[model samples]
Target: MDAAFAEYLDEFTRRDWETLDPDAVADPVRVAVVGLGWFAREWALPGIARSAYTEATVVTDVDAGAVEAVAAERDLTGVTPEELRSGAAADEYDAVYVATPNATHLEYVEAAAAQGKAVLCEKPLEVTPERARELVAACHDAGVPLMVGYRMQTDPAVRRLRDLLDAGVAGDVIHVHATMSQTMLGELGSDTDQWRLDPELSGGCAVMDLGVYPLNTTRFALREDPVRVSGRTRSEHEAFADVDEHASFRLEFPGDVDAFCTVSQNAQHASRLEVTGTDARLILDPAFYEREDRGFAVVRDGTRVDVDFEQVHQIEEEFAYFGHQLLAGEPFHADGEHALTDMRALDGVYESAETGRPVELGD
Candidate 1:
């Protein structure tokens, strides 16, 4: 066995979710979801609605009609984002899910934290690292648990891959490759002014919207921060005047491991991670930190190993786990430091693209 894998196996063991007794916990958490947009409705709300550990207390959005429509359809109560921000509408719930645009995450998180409520904010916690750090510190001071929506961490396939790495099954990870892309919003007939294409709101184009997925997944899978980053980007449509339509970057980690990730709003579909290690290689397809139809693949010494897993909804599992952690007063899995790292890496990617040089991460 590889020495690093042996060491990991000695320190940590993979957890079995099935063996866990569901009835061991009490008091389902009351959760209020802010932002009833695309993701909030498609993934977040439905996932939470199906979970046994949480109650969807309220749904809020800037568009009252949108929120009210979802509320009526789902039989949920609706609150205005303004009301939520003013704290008058938040007292009814124990937690808040912030699914607003990237620019508004900090404000919503701050408001939620001020109410001493635990929060799960969608990815790229804030537009900048400084803002992310401030929000993190505020949550810390308020003694509220803050978790970013890196739902891949809760995915069984991802969990299994992490286990293999830790168990030395894949030996020492040498390099990681990832690709996450989707058709352009304009091509999909989406409004040109969609927040995702607005750099001012989404932070960047493809990088922040889809690139962050692979970026965060790489960091989580390796459990290391990139020391340096290099990247490039391009845009085809004038509507995406402020943001790139496609972007690619290379990241260098501490132990000489490297990761290459590319994200594009111009691509046909998406791809997952292809990790190469000294002893073996593992491939996770359709890996967007979300639930997948087929499971992940493990190859050891030229032999393909199939790891069977049930389709576990990441959003549901993540919220459930967060609720349990909150009830138990345990530290959050995706904490402030994690959110800041994502932003810092994002900053580096932008810097690298502009300067045509590798940007060293950190202040």
Candidate 2:
């Protein structure tokens, strides 16, 4: 734990920890959301508003006018990135929520960490592994908490499956398959310069954007990193004229388990996860983006297991967990190292795809 936050705990006794007012800790972590993009406005902001451990303290972006507009609507003070860079603005929050473009995420993370605030960065930490390593190092040097926003890990079904794996309910995992696809080609359009379409800026579209869900889920299920990866890419639509519209990859984990992932920007709405072990298998439908809103079934042995999870908003659940782990002074699950590990495997996926060969991974 950082000395800064540790001091706060010194004020509380063990009894205080147990009897402390829940409302006192509710929205205890003041968060500065660094972007006003779609995800930020629609998902992250609302989640913070409803969180028991976090509150939206500030909103920032390079475009002052747009930020000001959002500030007016959300009753938040909008600050510009340039203002933060020039030190015109003081750090006013406990942590940062980075929902900016992939290219700009590291800068905001570093800026927030400069003031010793924790950070929750959106998924696919960087366009490349090198930048991800740098971000991880920055958080380490600052001694601030760093969590990657792999919200799938917050889902009840996903967590239950992870538990089952730990309990050996699925016996020994033998094979896994994950698929995440949406008709995003139309949403992203065919613009060659769109941030999502530009490999240099947003990284590869389907693989880097949507592929991380399956890849990370596989690792979470196994609780181990892939020793090797084999990948291949195909472009079947003009919508992805400049980038690969589809990518398929494989991860070789220990115990001779193989994980196959298929990703696409042109496919229909398809999000499913399956894991086969020696004794049984677990299946998750609409896996990547599932909340209890429309019930996500956890099927095993040809029957629906009656697992119950509180139906809180997905983002709220994630932020609540982040806040809990931070205040408890513990290492988090989706830490920088976790994201960096995913980046390494993802980088290997691309390399293998390009060379049409399997890329061996290293610890």
lDDT of each: 0.80, 0.77
lDDT of 2 by residue, 1-363 (tens): 235323332322122112234466844787888878767877888888776677787888866887998889988767888775443455567788888778788898888788788899998998888999889999999998899998877765566666667767668888999998987745545455567777777878888888999999888877888999999888876657667789999999987889999999888878888898876677777677633242334445576543333455778778777776776676678999999888998889889988988999887
Candidate 2: global Cα-lDDT? 0.77
Question: Tens-digit lDDT track for model 1 on 116-195?
Answer: 99988888888878788888988999988888888887766677677777776778899999998877664446678688
Query: Global lDDT for candidate 1?
Result: 0.80
> What TM-score fits each model?
0.91, 0.88
Best by lDDT: 1
Candidate 2 Cα misplacement greater than 4 A, ranges: 1-22, 187-193, 290-310
